[model samples]
Target: MGGWFRENILDAGKLPTLLALASFVLTFLITRTVTRLIRAGRGPFRNITPGGMHIHHVVPGVVLMVVGGFGAVGSGRYGVAASVCAVVFGIGAGLVLDEFALIVHIHDVYWSEEGRQSVEVVILATALASLVLSGFSPLGVDTLSPDEREDRVTVVATLVVNFLLVLITLAKGKLRMALIGVLVPFVAVFGAVRLARPGSLWARRFYRGRHRARARAALRSYRHDRRWDRPRRRLQDLIGGAPDRAD
Candidate 1:
């Protein structure tokens, strides 16, 4: 009996599982409360407000990174896997910038809007980076040998926990926007990269062609209704000794 228990549970060990559990619980509870608060304001908890939607959207992504990092270190994926997780996390931080921009645009709704948004995004991002680093590292399991199957408990738990974290963001209405917000920077940056390369020149040219066409249409309308024309017509009438300017 002892040997069977050791083979199943202790074979892969307990530290990784424990750490993942702790992270999952902490992030889940914290994010849920935050979402509830954002959806329902501070007064009597009865009032609904857009109090915390912005930061709540970002919390899950951060949780993933944290759990990934912890899995890397505890599972023994410390070499190249941890490094790759770090790089991806750096990219994720770049993604968070757009979210920050949105927060800036809607500052009137939040009290210390920028500060709160930044803190939440940064914390969640760090957690997610850690999880990725730990889970897929050499110690982790993104790559497995032909005959190998990882400890199913750890792998399954991680997937389930991350899914729940995401659901919290959606429990309110911001998940779709959060995903799009994260991807927007990636689209712009990758498109710019393609634009600079000669191989994708045709695609870039097509984009520019469309942009120029739109600009031309806008300019035509601007010239057709120039603001100066209105004032000039009034001045000309006054100089020509017509009726009063008011008329």
Candidate 2:
């Protein structure tokens, strides 16, 4: 185990990233737990409010992100100092992402239905990090032959093609698949080839004036939601507390 750790993580210079991913996940879980307790009035935890103005954790998180990001950049040496900076960045990211919905809406919607966006982003970030940890290189670079990698044009073309696929996947509204596709382009290709979700930008543009295509896309999306939405929401709720009903 130690040998694998040293060879794959330490020697490969991925120690800082590993530390960051660990810190990010741990900090998010801890933050959620604390917030849940506060919500339930079951612990000593309470929201931070000063002078009748609530100070969100994201404020400090932004500060830490700036400090850690610069520290990592300037350190230039991936040793103990670099690892510390990585942890700081991870903690800051967790805090900031926890309030992503509020940032987007410019209002406190932490417990509202819109709050699910935060959970979704965090999950996507975690999954993307995990894919990297698992040795998946972005843009299908790892799949190329050594000769192909040595060719500048081949590398650039591969990246461009994969990026286009990711963009199409995103347009189709398969955000999770689009994110994963950065690490594994095959997933993006699949999403791009599939029918777009109803009301997605792709469907809005391409399916316009094509009633059959629009109906098919809508039906497929409805079926998909029926099959997956509940369990997906349950999983999200399992990690982050369920969002409250709309007011």
Candidate 3:
């Protein structure tokens, strides 16, 4: 079984590997661009001709592009392992960007309760429209460079997938959604590293450490909440004519 798997899977990683690499490059570039723009004191989409833009909209599209590309390119490289990694990365991407995802969902959550959904709705709509356009074609830019078309397509696909993922979470909130939020980016990189270096036990150890950090963060939050409760109760008692120490 090991021999057959090795012969078939390990040897068939070239295309998927390339796709995964492409995803990594695209994601890194997009993330960096957004970060740089934010740091430059320039609001996102400032240079657009007329319609304006939300720079944050790039993340989801990048995530989805990677997911689709990796899945298609590496479907056979590691059997079920590849599929699992893809799902993990896809869900993780969805979860990590749950904030942006929530921007759209807030409308659903407070459809009648709030009035400021207009701005969020507008930004999100623009992003979704951009995704649709880019996913189907490059749209406006000159066609001098093939790489430009590929980049545009990847960005659009990523946005669509991530946006769809947000829709799914809004429709179905559960443990599965939470898990995906935490795992997509992690699993994509994890799977890629693992594929690139099957013998690296250190990678596995590093993931374990990450889990431990999450556990610690939860504990800290719980403690902080408990501390707040005691103080609130004391303040309420004092307000009701009971003596309470200032310290």
Candidate 4:
């Protein structure tokens, strides 16, 4: 275990990143627990309200993000200082993402169904970080040989090709695929070659007046949702707690 950490983490100069990832996940989990407790009114935990105005966690998160971000910028990427900065940044990210739905909706809805968006965003963020930690470099740069990397034209070409593929995947309305594809180009290729979602820009531009294609795309989307929606919701509920029932 130590050997693996030395080789994969230390040698790769990813100790700070690893530390940050750990802190990020732990912070999110802890924050969720406290918030849930407060919501249930089953523990001593309670919301932070001053002068009858609720103060959300995102406030401190932004502060940490600023401090850690600037600290990281000044300290480079190594040593104890960098590690500390990474942890701080990770905590900030966790707090901010935990309230992502509030940010997007511009209102407080932490216990409502809309709040599940925060869970989804955090899951996506975690998955992206995990992929990076697992040795997937942006735009598949890690896939290139040393020789290819030395050749500027080859490196530029590879990056451009991968970027276009990711863009196409995004345009096709496969947001998750496009995001993952930024790390794994093959995933982007899969998304790029697939049919666009019914209301996606790609579909609207290309599938216009094509009734059959629209029907097929809609049907595929519906089937895909049917297959994954329940499992996805269950996983979200398990991790972030279920939404509150409306009176």
Q: Cα RMSD (Å) per model?
A: 19.6, 1.2, 21.1, 1.2
lDDT of 3 by residue, 46-159 (tens): 432335644343345556647755765666655666655544443434323323323555433211223123223323333433333232222213322667557967656654
Off by over 4 Å in 4: none
Q: Highest lDDT: which candidate?
A: 4
TM-score of each: 0.24, 0.97, 0.26, 0.96
Q: Positional deviation of 104 in candidate 3, in angstroms?
A: 5.9
Candidate 1 is scored at a TM of 0.24
* Candidate 3 lDDT score relative to the true structure: 0.40
Residue-wise lDDT of candidate 4 within 155-231, one digit each (tens)?
Answer: 89989999999999999999989999999999999999998998999999999999999999999999999999999
Lowest-sum lDDT 10-residue window in model 3? 191-200
Regions more than 4 Å wrong, model 1: 1-10, 38-247
Residue 173 lDDT, candidate 4, scale 0-100: 95
Error at 170, model 1, angstroms: 24
The residue pairs that clash in candidate 2, if any, are none
Error of 1 at 72 (Å): 9.2
Clashes of 2: 0
The better-scoring model by TM-score among 2 and 3 is 2
lDDT of 2 by residue, 1-247 (tens): 9999989998888888888889988989999999999899998999998998889988998998888889888775468899999899999999999999999999998988888889989998998998898799989899989999899999999999999999999999998899899999989999999999988999999999999999999899899999999998998899999988756
The per-prediction tally of clashing pairs is 26, 0, 9, 0
Query: How many pairs of residues collide in model 4?
Result: 0
